[model samples]
Target chain A: MNHNLFPGFIGLSAALFAIGAVGVLVRRNPIVVFMCIELMLNAGNLALIAFGRFTHTMDGQVFALIVITVAASEVVVGLALITGVFRSGRGLDVDELSEMRE
Target chain B: MSVIFGLAAAVAVVAALGVVVAQRTLYSALALVANMVALAVLFLTLDAQFLAAVQIIVYAGAVMVLFVFIIALLSPGAQERLHPLEARVLIGGLAAVAFTVVVARLTLNGVSVAASGRFYGRLGPFAPVLVDRHGQVQTLGEQLFTTFLLPFELSSLLLLVAAVGAVYLSRRRRAS
Candidate 1:
């Protein structure tokens, strides 16, 4: 707890997370939205590790590690599904990915 | 108190602006990568070597590769551009303004959080186990496998499920 740790990273991460989330919600492209989700995960990881260092807890840093793996898996699955939807409906935009109205 | 942190913050803001204003999707992706790398460097400056290492190795190296790969697969050039204005921007703009005010308030209120990235014997044996010396693989390895094994295993399962689901979803469509 040196008061020197994390510093601007916390606020930076928050801003980045917000930007990514805004992009995801605003965009209709599956690929772009996927990138945004990845951005969001990275932001969460940054914040987690910042807290980890402040509290002297390995739990937070370790969780950040776990998040990395989960994010990688998410990309793989999410992209593949995107590709599948593309092949299935022949539509590349995410607004067309869903068949349900509600 | 402000040299490195300020620089890092500046980079973050510039890269974030790239994310918002870049007309090209590929450019946005690269800008996002820049943001991540800048963040990882900040973690290093914070003294969280483990977190820094994880940031570089995982988020920067692995996850980013996956993202770039998807972007390549998607072929950004083939996609058409969306119009500049939308209702989502209205909501997002409001949220962003609120966020700015909250952060400004925190700094103004003098609510300071500790800054060290290194553990200081505060979290029982865990902190000292990793610090105090250079060699921590044994203890870290032990804790990861034994005490925190359940979540570890669950995480692996999640990755596996995500992988399989990705494969299944990406599979080619059979002709009708």
Candidate 2:
């Protein structure tokens, strides 16, 4: 078992992050955008875990756990905000929610 | 092992693309589930057994359920045309490519430096031998309770705050 798989994992992580960035940029629906953000966070977690494994440390996994916790909470609050927007009869498109832009 | 890694990576990347390209929100959620599952497999390959389980249970199981439930509840219609040829889309794609190139270069450079034995950073206490003897979960648990205890407790507090905020935000208010 080649323990030196760090570069491959890092490359995959970078690709995933880029894809998530593109999703965030192009997606208009806030929920989808939020999902993109999760994708990006997951990408970061992948990199952290890879680094941890490469260096033989548990810190990376621990940090990844914290990231997961934060992501879960973010999903909760983000979905709630989206739900509120839906209930308020506002357009679901993120662009339409730009009342603060005025 | 490399074969498995390659397959899992392919699945993850394809699923991630599906998440972005799917027109229907439900499909996007499903794609994300697939992507997360593939990532869990990748985690297992990296010797992070505990994270693999957490990734599957928390990400694929709990978080995705919330996304799908919301999609069902709201039933937002499919998005309008994605306009792949639009100028904004083109620019965003270009930017993402540039970002990926820079990150990949940095990662490759760091790994190569580490490989060349130029910098041997201090390794942690949880080496593979110790981890293998004690099991990944036990070692992680010990560290989590001791060294990382503060962040662990802070995360719990953050979760509580998030729960309260979500409830307040979603509460029904009388029409003014």
Candidate 3:
């Protein structure tokens, strides 16, 4: 009970963020990429809650709540865009979305 | 207490890895759900009861359901494999390592436990584990409504806009 869980929490957040970043870079599937983005957001959420607890304030929690709200909206827009892309019959692989490669 | 935190963190990390490593989008989505649930437990360990509930309800429950629904709608295609020596993979691995090192170093060195010890441990160990069954929620509601009212309202407007945009984007165009 006297132990410090802060360090562990921070490290875990870092690991999760790193995993998500790698997923974003390596994955070609748009849906997988979107999931990785969500993973990164969750990592951020964990860090905010951990910091809030260690600091003993409601600021972090409120911010985390706002983040969750934003993330939900972001997902809605992202999924819609993905749906639009699917309708175009161009496939879901991000590598194939090179219209702006120039 | 430490055991609980350690177990939850381990499960969370492994599940997050699953989210990244799973080939199928559905499996990755499932892994993400596990990760979110594990994180909610971790939040509980941190005494953030309200946040834990929100994490479960919003991320694990709603957001994940949307992800799974989208994955099903997208339909499956040929899997893309990453070669070990490919430039993109190598670059991404290097970036990930660098980011992890920088973030962990900042966390260990920049933030000190002793500094926040006073505020963090104001309440003694016996300190009412629940922190007042309704106290946490009350505090959250007060701050959310008073100090953070603007952001809260803005977020609602944003959500409304996002919903409308999603519907517009997904709707089929009528033939002229």
Candidate 4:
């Protein structure tokens, strides 16, 4: 097992992050966008854990745990909002929720 | 180790792309589930056994189930195709690629300069600290209770707030 897998891990994380970013950019459905956001969060978590592994510390793992908690809360709130929007008959399109921009 | 990492990475990348490219939102959620599982495998390979378990139980199991439940509730029948290759998507894709390149470079540079940032401790002799069935979880629990206690308690509070807020927000309003 080669010890130099840091770059590989980082690069893979970046690619996953990019895919997530593009998904958020192009997706119209709020649920899909939210899932993409989760993807981005996972990418960041992966990086933190990898860095923790490299640094011989538990800090990165702790941070990853925190991030996962935050993401779970985010999904809860976000889905609540989505359900509210759906109930209000606004549909799930992100473009239609621009009333706040005024 | 590298082979496991490579295979997991490949699976994760493909599943991530599938999440983005799938036509139906349900399919997208499933793809995200696959991506999350693959990521958990990657976490295992990284020797973060606690994290790997958390990723599987929390993200892959709970979070994805929530997503799939919401998709079922939304029940968007016959998925509408967005105008693929549109100007906005094109620009977004380019920006994403550029961002990835910059972040990748920064990561490599930071790793090279940071103390104890070498590819050590992740595997080999020190691997047992994390990969050991009892040791890693116990260490993580000790740290969670002692060193990281404040944040741990705060996260529980956060979850409480989220639960309350979700219920409040989703409740049906009575006619005034």
Candidate 5:
């Protein structure tokens, strides 16, 4: 097995996920962290597809498709919420919003 | 065996690096998208056509975009903070590297998959199930409609409930 493309892809996806996770853990900015989370999700998508192909199953592909659709809808609604948060909180920093929970 | 694994390993590391190093959410999002696409290709090579498509449609397409859109909408001046993470990034990154090695070793230890991604031309062993039969989608639909209709319908209802809950959460809070 000399550099098979499938595992290569999986490896790349995993790398992306790791980076995203690091960003989430280390970044102070909420927006940046949010984006990193998305990056992680995408990485998982890649893994799913690779698994699907290897297993000769359509389930992974179908799940990926559904994920995409849900992502789109979520973005629309999420953005709206974010905008509202920004308006109220007056800043985009995650640490600043810690007060709202109480 | 080592060669193929190495390639996969290298790609994964690089893409992961890109996600961490990218300055903007858009860039990160793009990197993630690339990662997802690569996974899809990997899946295709593995002969998991169904999973590959779902990966594209569901995870890559839907989930990623939502993430991107949220960042775009909510993230204000996030780039300014990127430099801040640089302070302790070196120490943290080293740990990440160690983690990767351990996980990679584990993966290598478990599965001695065939050298080629495409071990079998078709699905089944020996001759493959080549019974066209309108493909997996059609058959899945038949199965769901006939045998697993209730679970399928319940899933839809659950999704609907989730949507409603999200709307409620986002609604403006009433002032006392």
Candidate 6:
């Protein structure tokens, strides 16, 4: 197909990013908030790949790969922290973890 | 093609909403899985065959399994409800809208400029014809290993650090 769907794909990416932002803002569960972060990262990857296709370059794809790698590492460390916090008898609500805010 | 793209995009948007709105954490995880699959389809439509595969394998496969496993391990109960008109929700919704508008405008303008032949960044050698001829994975792999080799190797090191950190963080605390 020779259709130019770049703009549409970008719009979709933007919408997804926005949804993820809202989720991150409003969700109390740390895991759900983490998932929203993943959603936002995936939206970024979509835009990267779309730009790659539009420009006939592989740089975007390579960058997206690196992004995926970083995201995976982030998830590992983040979940471990969450697990540790839960094991320490603290609740999982992000709003409740306000030790630093005092 | 447009029809399929539209379908996938719709699925992605709805699944994203599901992730945000699902009361149960497990349900939110499942909704994220659906969203990942829909994004893979979008990657395919964008002619990023290799990215589509990676999206499924890494995101939908490995990452999501990890998410579900953690959810199962912790079994964090349903999140406490927040009213639709809650101050937090209203503020977050408004911020998200403003962010979307700003980002969409910037992206649309950049894309239009690039499309209209005003952007002069030198296009890479891997044109669509060359990519199709050399195979998507092969071409992407070549560039990744060649031009992006340093970042690629560093990412491995980063993963190693993350693994060690996770193991240390999750390990049982010894009696002081």
* Top-DockQ candidate index: 2
Judged by TM-score, which candidate is best?
2
lDDT per residue (tens digit) for residues B1-176 in model 6: 99999999999999999999898998999999999999999889888988899999999999999999999999987566767899988898788778778877787687667666765245568777898899999998999899999999999999999999999999999979
The deviation in Å at residue A98 for candidate 2 is 0.5
lDDT per residue, candidate 1, B1-176, as tens digits?
36776787678667866766566777777887787777777777655666677777776688777777777776746544545565667788668667756764674343333223233325645564465464444544565688778878999999889877876776666778
TM-score of chain B alone in model 3:
0.84
Give the candidates in order of TM-score, highest first.
2, 6, 4, 3, 1, 5
TM-score of each: 0.82, 0.96, 0.90, 0.91, 0.66, 0.94
Compute DockQ for each candidate against the true complex.
0.52, 0.74, 0.63, 0.62, 0.34, 0.72
The digit string of per-residue lDDT tens for model 2 on B41-87 reads 99999899999999999999999999999999999985755778899
Evaluation by lDDT, superior candidate among 5 and 6 = 6
Off by over 4 Å in 5: A1-10, A55-81, A100-102, B1-16, B48-75, B81-88, B112-136, B139-155, B172-176
**Candidate 3: pairs in clash:** none
User: What is each predicted model's overall lDDT from 0 to 1?
Assistant: 0.69, 0.90, 0.83, 0.86, 0.59, 0.90
C-alpha DockQ for predicted model 4: 0.62
- Model 3 chain B lDDT-worst window of ten: B123-132
- Of models 2 and 4, which has the larger lDDT? 2
Model 3 TM-score, all chains together: 0.90
TM-score of 4: 0.91
For candidate 4, the chain B TM-score comes to 0.85
Cα lDDT, model 1, residue B78: 56
When only chain A is evaluated, what TM-score does every model earn?
Answer: 0.88, 0.95, 0.95, 0.96, 0.81, 0.97
Task: Find the 10 residues in a row with the least total lDDT in model 6 chain B.
Answer: B115-124
Ordered list by lDDT, greatest first = 2, 6, 4, 3, 1, 5
In candidate 3, position B10 carries an lDDT of 89
Candidate 4, pairs of clashing residues: none
Put down candidate 5 lDDT per residue, B87-158, tens digits, no spaces: 567656666666556655554543444434345334631111431445655644554576566655655665
Segments in model 1 whose C-alpha atoms lie over 4 Å from true places: A1-7, B78-87, B103-132, B135-142
Instruction: Name the 10 consecutive residues with the lowest summed lDDT in model 3 chain A.
Output: A1-10
